[model samples]
Structure formats: structure tokens, C-alpha cells
Target: MTAPSVVVLDYGSGNLRSAVRAVERAGARVTLTDDFDAALAADGLLVPGVGAYESCMRGLRAIKGDRIIGRRLAGGRPVLGICVGMQILFARGVEHGVETDGCDEWPGTVERLQAPVVPHMGWNTVEAAPGSQLFAGVEDERFYFVHSYGVREWELVTNDRTAAPLVTWAEHGGDRFVAAVENGPLWATQFHPEKSGDAGAALLHNWVRTLT
Candidate 1:
């Protein structure tokens, strides 16, 4: 069987190296590139993000990853968006005010945490959706998360109508935020599975297995 080619989109953001290595360790042939052509041709795509959501979206738009992502999704290719990457998949994000400051509304909006602190760091448990392939053989357990802004609502409403599925994995049902979302071939997680130790590896393996 041909090994699945996993394309990791790079846009000069946070520690993507860790993500590259982790995906490789999961038995995928990793290709690190920002080129839209190469990204669109992959068997599966990984959109991992860190730092602020606005900055991440800006870089993504600058490099045209947004278009490539849309094309791939339209073509039915599986995708995994991590961290801030996941936040950008929604309709809008209220993070960092970069999107709001520029007079251009972001697709998703993040809100301030009422928790004791802003950025919710460390490990937190995740409850998978009823039938999530991303959580295959994986129990609902703690994954690494470090962020202040999170997805407020999974289903975005506009013109007095509801939009499509934003993040479809495991929704952070509590007062925290959206943890993950799963929609057919698309899966996104607010937490960094690459930083979740063995469980993270398991998640990566399951993701690759889905592509196969």
C-alpha cells in the first residue's frame, strides 16, 4: 500500500516543527510546504496553528492557504486543524482584535475566558462526538491546550439562518470553549494532540488510519 502523504501547511507561525515530527512518527510521509499547489495535491492535510488567531488567519490568507483548504475540503480530502487553526475554521474569531481592528470580520470569534486565568494551559479532558473516527481506540482523556480565546459556538447563524458545521469534533461542553469538531472527512481540535504524549501519537495514528 502506498503510504499516505500528509501535507503540513507552514505559514511562519509557532512550533510547527514539533507537529511535523509527530505526524512523521505516526507513519505518514510528511511534506512541509506553504505552496498551495503541493498542499492541494496531498492525500491528507494538517493545518496546525499557534499564537493569536487573527495573526494565524492573516498569514493563512497571505499565503493563500485559505483557498487551498477550501478546494481540498470541497474535493473530499480529510483535514485536521489544530489549535488556532481550528478556531479559524468557524465563521468568526474574537481573538487578539487583529481581525476586528482591521475592519474585516474574521470567520470565527473568540471570547475572553471567565476562568481564573485567561489562557487555559495544561491538560484537559476531551469527550469525543458520538461517532468520531479521530478518536478511534482513544478514550476521552486529557490533551494539551494553551490558549486564551476559543470557539464560542459551533453552529454559526447568519441572516436569521444557521450556517454549516464549523468545528465538528469534541465540543467543549463546559464554560471553556470549543475543544474539537468533526464533519465527515474534516476533523479539528483546539488542543495540540502533538503535545499530548502517547495519547497524541495515538490520535495521529488514528487520523492517518482514517485516510487509509
Candidate 2:
């Protein structure tokens, strides 16, 4: 089978070069661009951010990639967000201010991780919920994380997993924050899969598997 095309978003907020390298190394044709049209043309979209949520969203808006990303998600295209990119997947973000009018407010609220520190940087274990395609063979694996804000639990928790409380843990500014979330074809993580070594590569591969 031919490998699918992957587009790693380069909106000037994250290490997109690293993400592109990782995707290419995983046997996918990779394109690093800030162009929304190019992003829409790819088989998969990886939105990676390594800074403030509001700033990342501003960067995305500057290039209209936010529009493209929102449209793609609504259309059922597979889109993945890393770190701050993940927090932007929500409906509102309290990073700097309320996101009353933007893509961040589309899914859920983005809030600071109520942990004991800021920029939760390091490896953290993530256990996949039942029936998540992004975690087909991944039960419990550690991924590198570095962020201060994330999507709240109510946003990603589903009907099937209602009984299972949404538990996302990461530290930021002496408070705990959400770490990961998923809704349909849209999945977000508060970590850097590319920096997670083999397990991270496997995550990219697993994301590609969901393209079909």
C-alpha cells in the first residue's frame, strides 16, 4: 500500500521542521507549510504548537490556517494537534483571555493545567480510552509534553465513556491542566510525539492509519 501524504503545520509557533522530519521518517510524504490550501490537500494534518495558546491561535489566524483547520475538522478530515495546538482545538481558552470568538471556542474551553508548575515538560503516560482509533495498539505509552494549557475534560469525554471520568493531568503555573482530548476525527495531545522517539513515530503511523 502507498503511504499517505502528511502535512505538518508551520505557523511559526512550534518546531515544525522536527515534525516534518518525523513524519517523513515514518514513510509518509511530508509537507511543512503555513498555507491553508496545501493543508487541505494533504491526507492528514498535524497542528503542532509549543507556545502560548492565544499566541498560537493568533499565528494560525494570521495565515487563515485556523479557518482551514476548522473547516477540515468539521468536514471529517483527520486532524491532530500537539501541545498548544491541542488546546486551540477547544471552544474557549483562558490562557490570556476568553476566546469568545474563535476556533478555540468551537470544541471546548481551554484552561490552565491545575498542576504545581508551568510548562509541564517531560514524559507522561497516556492510556487510550476504549474504541479510540488513534490508540489502536497503544494502551499505555509515555509521550513528551511541554505546555501550560489544555482542553477541559467535558469537551473530549464521549457518551460511551461517560462513566469513566475524563482525567487529563499536566502542570502549569502551579496548577493542573488538561493533557489530551479527542472528538471524532479530531485528536489532540499535550505532548511532542516526534520527541518521544519510537513510540511517537508509532503515534504518527497510527494517525495515518485513521485516514481511511
Report residue 15 deviation for candidate 1 (angstroms): 1.9
In candidate 1, what are the lDDT values of residues 157-210, reduced to their tens digit? 445353334333332324646777766567788889899998889999989877
lDDT of 1: 0.75
Pairing residues by index, what is the TM-score of model 1? 0.86
Q: lDDT score, residue 91, model 2? A: 71
Alpha-carbon RMSD, each predicted model: 3.9, 3.5
lDDT of 2: 0.72
TM-score of every model versus the real structure: 0.86, 0.83
- Among these predicted structures, which one has the highest lDDT? 1
At residue 139, what lDDT does model 2 achieve?
53
lDDT of 2 at 206: 78
Residue 163 error for model 2, in Å?
15
lDDT of 2 by residue, 91-189 (tens): 767756655344762356767666666656788776566665555565577778776666545644446743443334544454545555556667777
